[model samples]
Target chain A: MSAQGQELQRQGLERPGLQLQAQVARSDFVLDVHIAQPRGRVLAIVGPNGSGKSSLLQVVAGLVSSAQGIVVVDGDTWMNEDTFTSAEKRSVGMVFQDYLLFPHLSVQENISFGLRSRGSSRAHARATTADWLGRFGIAHLAERKPRQLSGGQSQRVALARALVTQPAVLLLDEPLAALDAQTRVSVRAEMRSHLSQFCGVTLLVTHDPIEAMVLADDICVLDQGSVVQCGTVADVTRHPATEYVAKLMGLNLVSGIATAGTVALDSGGQLVTTNSDLTGAVLATLRPSAIAVHRQPPQSSARNAWEGVIRDMEHLGDRVRLDMEARPSVVVDVTSQSVVELGLQPGQQVWLSVKATEIDVFKAHDEA
Target chain B: MTTAATRSPRRSRRSKPPWVLAIPAIIALAFLLIPLAGLLMATPWTSVGELLIDPVTQQALRLSLATSLLAAGCALILGVPLAWVLARVQFPGRPLVRALVLLPLVLPPVVGGTALLTALGRRGIVGAPLESLFGITLPFTPAAVVIAETFVALPFLVLSVEGALRAMDTRYEEAAVTLGASRMRVFWRITVPLMAPAVVAGTTLAWARALGEFGATITFAGNFPGRTQTVPLAVYTLLETNREAAIALSVVLLAVCVLVLVILREQWLRPGALRS
Candidate 1:
């Protein structure tokens, strides 16, 4: 390697890897997070609303308040104890949730904004912008203003515009969130393909489970402004450590205190589980599909039973999700045919039965 | 198509509008229009060209245009930055500062003239030092006319541009900065261009106000033909002796006011221009 390459490696930015340790105080919400990723990887942060997902991205991009952090990206120490880089100086690209394309500028100018700002001649910027337009298959929209474009076209333009800067660290905040459901699938595929070609550290913030599962190499679940679980997509889905993560994977999570013989739930209920000699706090999860719905209380082999009114019923194609207001308020998924057989309305009372073996009980805290 | 008035489905079923409201509306319309109608009636139409060609009248008209334009230029240079600061920045006593900027709008022009005299007149605070140091007396000069006009006209420009700056979505500016543009570049390229319609509206308003200025110009910058006497001040002098010439000049000023409103309606005041 050349001397410059070795210096870049020393700064930990040669391969477009990222290391960020930051703490920011925003009104009542304090965000204390440490995130790291090697180059050529995408870290998808899945979180509920108001979970500091966007703020985390903002701090590393040098857009937010005076966050204390050491942000080393692509061999540049953008921020640390002594150095602080403004958003205008740091080569960071972000696609905001709204896209925020300059409404007054044409598609070409929007894409070429970064180049023009970097002091490129108008002719060079225009040529590079046109190249990106062609690459993104949006050359036909080169002259059209943002308002003249459709939602899908605007999203494509936003993506192309971000990549035109050739940023070392790419940040996407809910990139697919603005599209209608029909456009999301096709756009997601296109976005995934484009992201795969980029040799950089990409941090994607999304609330949708499918978006995280499909696009991310690893998943980092954030709750209340802290990372609750970080692992491969399959691992986090299979053994979620938090209730929020369980809900994302379409499972009913029940938190309980495990004694010698039984597990006592916080919502005034007890359950018998197959796991032996578990103590202190534990989280037990049941697949929504595994719970059986009955009109009357059943005396079957199932070890747990609860009678509750249906709080909400969401029709999910062939299945219906019953948000039942039982002792612990569990989500039960039943087939649409069974929903009709049981004549389930939101106010109708029903019995829920779950076998002991079906519940997966794990220690609630990773430290514990 | 949606904005073109659809026939009111409910109007046909309702009774006629009350005479109580109708009478006052007619009175209000006539009250404002009758003076204009009388002015048109009084204009000496026959030798109007010869009257306009008269050297004194021409000079006052030229002086009026010159002073107002210069005042508008000064106001533009100063008011734009003030408006930007007022709209975009947070500071202590902002409300008080804004109120002080708008004081001239509510103060009678004569009172504003008196205030200007105490501040800029030869015997006054800054005026004494200026006169002693530079040997330059500002009163009874064209520069004084512009000073008076700018003093009274700045509020209009500042208010309009500030409202425009506040209404614009600041996200575009943030995006520009994120794209590596400096704050100055973003302001020039993004903020100023977005403020175009409002700035034009404000400039026209200030120009009209300056051209019609009588009290302040006459008091601070004494009325002198071909110098400080604008059209309104010239008309005031003519009212004492030459009624016909005064009427002609009044007609001229009225025509310019109408012309300005017509041009304003076509450009900045149009519904379409304000939408963006």
Candidate 2:
């Protein structure tokens, strides 16, 4: 450790990662969150619209002055009660949602803007910018303006512009949300590779679960200005904490009281799970694909069964998702061939059944 | 065929403006154009070259161009920062300051000259200390002409630039800052480039306004031939003694104003030109 790191440790503030505790109050919303992630890890902040996910990123980047927080990155304090570094002074880089590239500048000038503004010589800035342009496979586009570039090309330019500064903390807000579906797939793969090579701590704010799952190492679920859950991808995907997270993960979550092998669901239903040791308050998550739909009551070995009305049906490429209105409403996915065979339509009555072993049960948070 | 069918309604809608509006609009157009037509018709075209080469005409034209250009340059330097402050900063009494800055636009030019006199004249408030301290006299000089022109023309630049600054997307500046660009860098490299079209439009308007200034120049900077006399003041003076020269100068002023409007129409006034 360096002398500064030792001094930080002496002050009980040394941490080899990003530590942020922020509270921002507005007229209509208040965002309060505390997050810590190790260096070189990409933490994805996932939330619905107006969930303060972007506000958290802005606070960490020193763009929100009304926020009261302590942001320390790799043992360097960027913000504290007495010391508040502005965005320009902090070693941070951000790619905005719309990719706000300077429209007046060419791609080369746009990429070199950070270095030039920080007092780099013209030749030095040009050399570094050219290196980044070549690295991003956009060397031929160096003379083109932003408007002339495609959405995917613009995103790459924005990423290269942000990365060329070699910032200690990189903030990307909806990095791939602006691309079309066809472009998103290819760009997402490229983004994953670039993020894997990045040595800085990254905070990616996105609403898409697939983006989080494919890009980030851990996920932070935010709802209404508060973090509902924060954990690894596998843990959060297998066990979501709130209805929002459950819906985002495509699971039917139910609150219940567990005893032995049975759960008395709060939504006027009973669920039998294979977790025999679980007791007290718990959440049972059932994957949509795990539930089987039938025209008549199943006589098979499936344990839990319920009668439901098909409220709506949506086609998902090769599969069909049915919104079943049962005692505890749930979503079920079946093959399109099965849907055609059964002739499933809205307002049709059906039987839904799932195996006890397929239902994952876990203890709910005490406050929840 | 589909394109024509889809565009027919819009074409018909444009072809038939309401009669109530069309009548008054045509009348207004004729009302503005008739005088320009009369000026071109009444000018002594055969003697125009001789009159334009006269030493008095040359001096007045040179002085007018020099003063107006200097005034526009000064307005560009001072007014853009003022506009930036009005559009970006949040300070007490800013609205009042903006109103005061725009006061010269509506105030009579003679009244503006009088106001400038009270502040900068030799016998006036600050002028007394200025003379005692620096041995300077501002009134009835070429410097006074530029000052008066800048005073009356600055608001034109400020209003347009401030409007453009307000309409600009500040996200670009924020993005620059996050990329480690300082506030000054962002202003020069991002905000200014983004608002370039408006700046050009505003500077042109201010230059044209300064070029045509008569009441203020006559009042503050006394009309002395070849020294303080601009084209407009010279035209006023020559109308009594040399009617043909006055007509030729009026034609020159008319041609310059028309050229300014044409350039504005082609470049900055178009809808698409202002946008990125």
Candidate 3:
């Protein structure tokens, strides 16, 4: 570690990383959140539209002055009741959702804007900007204006511009959401590598679960401007707190009460799971691909089976997803060949079976 | 696709515009153009060179160019910050302030000069103190001409710049602030550069309006040849005694107005021009 890093570590022994507790009240919506993350960790805020994910990021970056609460980053107080630092005074770097690069400036000029604004000498700023351009692998685009660049190139330039300042906190709001699918894949991988190398606190706001899973160390789920669940990515994906999260994670969630190895589903069905130690209230989730669909009732060794008419059928690339309206509604995914052989269609009666080991059960908490 | 492509031209040709609209449009065009045609016809084209080089004509053109350019400079310096405040700041009674800034656009130029006289004339409200404190007199001078021109031309620049500022995307400014740029730095490095086209358009408009100012100059500065008289005032003065010189000067002013229009069209009125 460098001397500054060592000094930060010494100061962080008492108060590490980031602690933010803020409430921003607009006319129609209110965002109240409390988040804490250790240094050198990435926290992904995932939620549906209008769930205050971006609002929370803005509050932390000091872009919203109406936010009332405390924000501490690396043992420094950025906002509180009596003192609210403006965004310009705070050491923060943010990539806005649209990659709002300066349209009139060349790529090199845009990257060096922050350094020049902070009173650095022109030669020093130019050298630093050149280093960032080389690091981001966009040195050839240094002379081009923003309009001449593609979406992926713009994203790279925006990232290079934000990171060239070397702020303590890096906030990315849907950084890859603007690119096309093919470009997004490559840019996302590049972003992951860069983010891994950054020695700072990162807060990523995205609605894509795959992005959150691949990029974030921890997941924070928000719904209706409030935190629904906060845990490690594995913990949150394995056991979701709400139906939204379960659907986002591509799982079928059923709420019920457990006794022994059986769970009395609240939606009027019984699910047998391998978690025999669970008692009282619990939430059980099973992957759609794990559930097998049958045209006729079979004497299979599966622990649970139910008969229902197919409510809807959706084609998803190589597989077809069927929504079955059974005692406890469930989604089942089957191969397209199987779908063709069985001639599955809406209103067709089908049998769904899942082995007991496929159902993951956990204790239920208060609803989000 | 081939049939549709072949049929499109005939289909468009068959859709002729209504005679009701075309007849009045032609009449309106003639009504606006006939006076310019008459002026071109009445000019003594053979002696136009001699008339243009006359002492009075030369003096008026020089003073007009110098004062109008100076007035444009003054407008740019004062109007841009006023426009920024009007567009970005959210103080109370902002609409009222904006209305007051734009009042000179609709008020008569002579009335604007009268207003300037009350406020800035010698022995006037603020002018009395200026004279006693600084030993300066502003009425009937070249400086008074510039002051008068700026008073009438300022509204054009302010209105144009304010509209552009409001239409600009503020996300770039927010991004700059997050990148550790102070508000002043952002204004200079980002906002000013982004609104460059509007600033250019506004300054040109102010310069043109200042060049054509006549009533305000005569009322506030008094028509002193070579000192306070601009092209428009020169044409008015020569109209009674020297009709041919007056016609020649009017033609020059007409040519300048056409040139301004051409420049504006090239910069902003192109079919698919992108301002920023």
Clashing pairs in 3: none
Q: What is the C-alpha lDDT profile of model 3 across A69-183, one tens digit per residue?
A: 7787888878776668888888888888899999999999999988887778999999999999988889999999999999999999998888888888889999999999867
**For residues A1-368, what per-residue lDDT tens digits would candidate 2 score against the true structure?**
44643444334355677888777775577877878888798999998888888888898888888887778888777877777888898888788889999999999999999888777899999999999888889999999999999999999999999999898888999999999986886687678778888998999999988778777889999887788899987567655665567568676667688999899999888988898987887767788899999899999899999999998777656767787789668878788999999999999999999999999776653221
Give, for candidate 1 chain A, the lowest lDDT window spanning 10 residues: A1-10
Docking level of model 1: acceptable
**lDDT (tens digit, per residue) of candidate 1 on B1-276:** 443445554465365667888799999999999999998898889978888888889999899999999999999999989998999899999999999998888888888888889888899898999999999888889999999999899998888788778878887777787788888888877777778878888888888889899888888888888888788988888899888889999998898888878867855566544331
Per-residue alpha-carbon lDDT of candidate 2 for residues B245-267, written as tens digits (9 for 90 to 100)? 99999999988888888868854
DockQ of each: 0.47, 0.64, 0.62
Q: Provide the lowest-lDDT 10-residue window in model 3 chain A.
A: A4-13
In model 2, how large is the Cα lDDT of residue B114? Answer: 92
Score residue A292 of candidate 3 by CA lDDT: 88
Q: What does candidate 3 score on TM?
A: 0.78
Model 2 chain A: lowest-lDDT 10 consecutive positions = A4-13
DockQ of 2: 0.64
Q: How high is each candidate's interface RMSD, in Å?
A: 1.1, 0.8, 1.0
